[model samples]
Target: MNTVMHRKPKPYRSERTTAHTSDRNASAFPSKRHARRYWILLSLFLFGGLLCSLGLLLYNNPVPVQSPSFWPVVERRITAVTTMAIAALCQSLATVAFHSVTNNRIITPSLLGFDALYSTIQTSMIFFFGAGALIGFSGTKAFLTQVGLMLVMSLLLYGWLLSGKYADLQLLLLVGIILGTGLNSLASFMRRMLDPSEFDILQARLFGSVTNADPAYFPIVIPVVLIVSVLLFLSANRLNVIALGKDVATSFGINHRRSVLYILILISLLMSMSTALIGPLTFFGFLVATLSYQVASTYDHKYVLPMAFSIGFLVLTSAYFFMYHIFNAPSVVSVIIELFGGLIFLTVLLRKRSL
Candidate 1:
């Protein structure tokens, strides 16, 4: 009777609900606008990067060849652009996926011992098989073998850690850091024992340089990248949910473990491709991922991934251009990139933001 006499319940619009509705409305169409803006920015960045690279190519005198026609020059430019583009794409994708899985911006796949493992494997190959043995193998075969070994090692390390009772995200990260340190020590020991000439060859392999990219690897890298890109695009929405943390993602009916595993695999493949193509980039991934996050200002993977790729392409291309053309130091591009990337890394840390 009391309920019957009670005034019709007011529409159940709590303040929180009202606020949520407002937020939803505000963000709804704005994402589309942001998407458009991002595409425009991406196009502009690509143009700038290309222009810089082209300018560098033109300014540099080509090596004298049987054919001095522009076609050869065009081919060289194409090759350079293609290699850099692939490297950037792989690094950016790996970085973004790595951040999503670890739920941390400051960390990159490289930090998790991928690069270290790569170095160890390369050094071991040189030590046991000798430089001559490695030379006997084609570049593509060596690259593929390196990638395969890295993947196996990564899986073993990550799988072992994940199989433990305390294998939470933080634990995985801690283990990664420890493993990376150990691997670095081993690599240092190997380097110290190597002859100066061997060390020179190894030193070039350790740094993230694009100058000596093997063209044969391009065929393998391009297809792998395309396939992974498709997989990533399909899983973008899942990544967004995963970023909300494990419980929320589970609540959303996402298979959190499976999602994480898939993402990790994709990340490892990307890391492998990038490392095999150029060399280990300790900071490039972190730099691009952080910059992309800042520029996008959104946690949605759909926006974040593409933006990261664009930014990476722009950075690498521009760096290559400047180092070659202006500085006349193609060999120093990696150093320059790391210098700026390090500064940005510090800035990000000071701001206390995650990529």
Candidate 2:
């Protein structure tokens, strides 16, 4: 009997396998290194640009550096910086946390009606008490009033909706949208009734203006923003888990309802402070948070949060620099931001084919 030597069969590589291998080999190294490099470069660019914008804000004034008039200019500059910092922190942290809890990058905390609420409050004040009362209510007292009202309303709405056993995120979001719509309608009615003079006065406060921030309110805003932001930062890892969906988060030992309630409360307070401080910023937070995700290219809140803050600061400073110095139209900053942000929102929605 002639025994044939057995030959080992070589593994066959199909076209699909070859293509996949080539794709993986081509993409693997560059993808990772590119992400890392993008993070580093973005951080440097934002930080450096912030510094330059700040320098321009401080020294570009007509006041002589050696004159006694310089101190007042410097004081204004300091206040501007502080306002921008608080706005950046509040908008960045709140929006990022809001997006994580909701698990939707396209939506922002603005859905909660902070901006609409702000407009309603201002309009009501002017409608009933007149523009003089609105002006008189300015400064620290007005800031505190707005923050307190916003915080209480948020607590009432969020607590009642989220503390129950059947806490549903969709339901809560629906209620918020209804409330926002109602508030906006009321504000619109009030605006239509106002005389042109009263409307003019109300319009100034309607826009988001860093210059409108009072330094005295800084004492109140600074601590609240810092403390709440730190709390959110500490929960960053949990936020990552929450973004995975409720069932997955629960399996990981996270109490989905409780965590979401706590995060919502924090977001409310943050949005309140920012809105009370800068008036209504319809799209500032959305813009910053969206850009942060794109620039940082990571879902890890540890990286995303700081990047959001940096990007927020960079955007605010750059806009202020150009608007104040170049166009002398600082009040238009909000308009410009909202215009761009609305465009971005439409683009994102069209691309995703979902809300």
Candidate 3:
């Protein structure tokens, strides 16, 4: 009876095998087309929004539209646009590249104490030379001094913390944070000693504003931003590899240390120019970079970089338009941006459960 019905068993394929095959196919090229399409649509929308914001800023004035006041309004709008553009590029490119090199999302270029150092420079100029010196400090020489100091300081930190057989990025960041805190402390102490009027003047300088940037500085800032941005765009391929980790990057014949060093230097320069121009924007870079990653939905630097710039431009221009036109308080734009960016930072930190 047992031998009577020897039927051949069908070839066996379990549910696990089927599921794994499905997973592999699902992950191999998942959502890439959708991401590309989304980026294209988002790009068009942002560009349109930017143009509308520009129009609002330029043409939506209360003073007589056809009077001599029109020229002043036009001039102011032009300067605002120029400042916003430079700020956008600087924040976008520097933040994206900084994130790539550090491979960390929570921190920003501000960690290196560019803002704190700027505060110190201002406070010291006020504390030692009195607040009136700030007037003289607004010229081109002071701009150059600020850029030079930041460059030298960043260079020293990079060389000190990232040049050994065991280059430790954590140590560098920790030291930077510490120095920044110390510098802030000194500035605060000095601020406390200043007269009310001088302190008020220093306080004004602390707030980042498109109007605060001197037009004379734009000549230098535009060129520096353009050159650094082009360099960053060219290095996108290297940054992509670097994002994979030092070990993986080395495996691909990338000099991980050198690439990182160079990236930091370039980032320092960008931050210096931006900070020197607009004071310290602790959140704009972080906000734009985070939004860029989410909206672009891809890891490729080529796509992400331009997306970051566009988003930054859109955010800055829209903020300027709303604050200057709608709220009648442009000085608070940095505060609003920093507030939202801090909330985003907290949300991301809780969600990721890791730095």
Worst 10 residues of 3 by lDDT: 22-31
Top TM-score model: 3
Instruction: Name model 2 segments beyond 4 Å from true.
Output: 1-35, 340-355
Task: Point out the higher-scoring one by TM-score: 1 or 2.
Answer: 2
Cα lDDT listed for each candidate: 0.79, 0.83, 0.84
The sequence of per-residue lDDT tens digits that candidate 2 reaches over residues 205-256 is: 8888887788898778898889999999999889989989899999999999
CA shift of 107, model 1, Å: 0.5
Quality of model 1 by C-alpha lDDT: 0.79
RMSD of each: 5.5, 5.3, 4.8
Residue pairs with clashing backbones, model 3: none
Show the colliding residue pairs in model 2: none
After superposition, the stretches of candidate 1 with alpha carbons farther than 4 Å from their true spots are 1-37, 61-68, 163-167, 345-355
Q: What are the TM-scores, per candidate, against the unseen true structure?
A: 0.85, 0.86, 0.87
